[model samples]
Target: MSDLNRWMQKHNLCPENILYLYRSDRKTVLHRMDGGEAALYAPMHGVLSVLPEDQFLNISKGIAVNRSQIVNIGNDGVYTMSDGRTFQGRKRGLSSHRRLRMEIGLSDTKPRPMSMSLLEKCSLLDDMPLAFCVIELVFNEDGHGVDFIFRYCNAEMANIEGVPVEEMLDRSFYKVFPNGDKKWLVSYADVALNGTKHTLHDYSPEVDKYLTIHCYQPEPGYCACVLQANEP
Candidate 1:
């Protein structure tokens, strides 16, 4: 297992249990749902560096939070934690906070049943020959793009990546493929934020192959990419 995963397992830190991390004195303290705090013997930046990017939202230089633990966001850049503590972040953090709140709300909500015809029409995409996937651009609470989460992937996409669709769904793209090019990350974020289409040819170290990708936003905050494996 990776160091990050091992650290998470060592501390028993899971999404439902971890509240947030705060810098206190010379150490970084991890706050838990059970009303306990553990001081990590590392610099705040070091601790933040090891955290799973998709799971932690940095509210400020000294505060990082689990998006799921946020209860509500108030005007003037104040956020109420699930444990009822309020943290006022910088004014610049407000936009990112609101975006995170909206993303969480959408994910937690259940979609209404669609008409049978509509469902059938949507299913047609699954039969497409091209490898397809939808990615959610993750951001820090300060409004900077950090990483990406795989929201959906078709069987062809999974096969092309040599992973199961179930394994890719809702998992951090970086965690799965740590060697992914930074250029791809930039392109994904641009398409997600600007609603423009981008096409690129890149080599995937993970799959030991080259790939041609066309990326575009299906909606704000989400990117849909179609991949084609290129000749060696």
Candidate 2:
């Protein structure tokens, strides 16, 4: 484990007060408007996952700035912050936010996607405090695991991934996280394909959080995973 994982502490900050996030090596330093810094040993993208998507956008692959902190977003792929600091946001990120602006005029373009079979089995679990999701396994012709698509995601599951509930539904796990650990596919596949119920404790260096994942097959080719995370 990295030093961040060996010694993790929780820091609660108001989302609005966050000014910018800068990643140095594997540690992400949250530079606040008040000159305070909260450091987390986590991947940049992983940290971005838990922020308010509407308020935070990646300036570059290595940096994400709060929308409130931006002084102006220039047409030249550069953004200036209220703190007199400027950084280049990725063109793809800017385009995505432009698309996000387009989504404002539209309302719920599609209904939330869910798997009835998984939903039924999920109801059997009486865990109100944990985050959980039901996912369908995607496989290659060789029957090996490739990815899992979200069939049903509870609100808490969205909090875990730092995405909104509607945004996660019916989305590919790899699509959202292109470089997500392959071990996750293996773990979920073991439960879904073989009905092997199990649990695992994992520490995410990227998000600087500890996780306990409880997995079970809700139906063939589908599994439900209960997630509990903290900065302990």
Candidate 3:
């Protein structure tokens, strides 16, 4: 059960080690739980777009907090973290967070109990019968495709590839499938960069399976695949 803390620590404070994100001078400062801070060139919205919403609460137009760790919101507009840290919050944000928590099925009357985050349930797609994966394309300085990162894969995908899910996520795709029969860069690149949908009917020598593979862009710079095995 990997929680947000471990995930953010490994991800280098890109997400949860950050208890508070403050926007200053058009730059976002990530105030980490370990008492360190880092500056991000981008705005808070850009960073939050890729993160899970379960823990984030916008304390202001330019400030967000990890509300899951917050234990109390005082009438004086101060929020108390479970670790006894306190931050001055805005009234606009306090009301907004209460409504959001209730809408999202979290209790608004008390502190949040410790629980597994599960990457905000993004991988819940694991229940699908066919193999599914999300690959993020990597490019060189010249904007040419060099490789791709395996951002996620369902259990069915792990089974089809004969690799563990943990072994694939955030890893190089070619490293996992060293014996790839055909070069996939062209197809995947076009899909990730141009939002094109492509399908291929081919066999994977690595897994010894013939399949109809459908590739599409779920978001910019990312390709999602649904592999239906013909040999099944």
Task: Give candidate 1's whole-model lDDT.
Answer: 0.70
Pairs with steric clashes in candidate 2: 42-206, 43-206, 59-89
TM-score of each predicted structure versus truth: 0.49, 0.45, 0.46
Best model number under lDDT = 1
For model 2, give the RMSD to the true fold: 17.4
lDDT (CA) for every model shown?
A: 0.70, 0.66, 0.67
Q: After superposition, how far is residue 78 of candidate 2 from its true place, in Å?
A: 45
lDDT of 1 by residue, 141-202 (tens): 43223467887677798778988888888778877887766557657766765577889898
Model 1 residue runs over 4 Å out of place are: 1-122, 140-145
Where does model 3 exceed 4 Å of error? 1-121, 140-145
The prediction achieving the highest TM-score against the true structure is 1
- Model 1 poorest 10 in a row by lDDT: 106-115
Model 3: per-residue lDDT, tens digit, 43-79? 6886676567877877767878886555445444555
Q: Is candidate 1 or candidate 2 better by TM-score?
A: 1
Off by more than 4 A, model 2: 1-117, 120-127, 140-145, 205-208
- Residue 92, model 1, lDDT: 78
164-228: candidate 2 lDDT, tens digit per residue: 76877787877766656655655676676568887988875433568888899877667788888
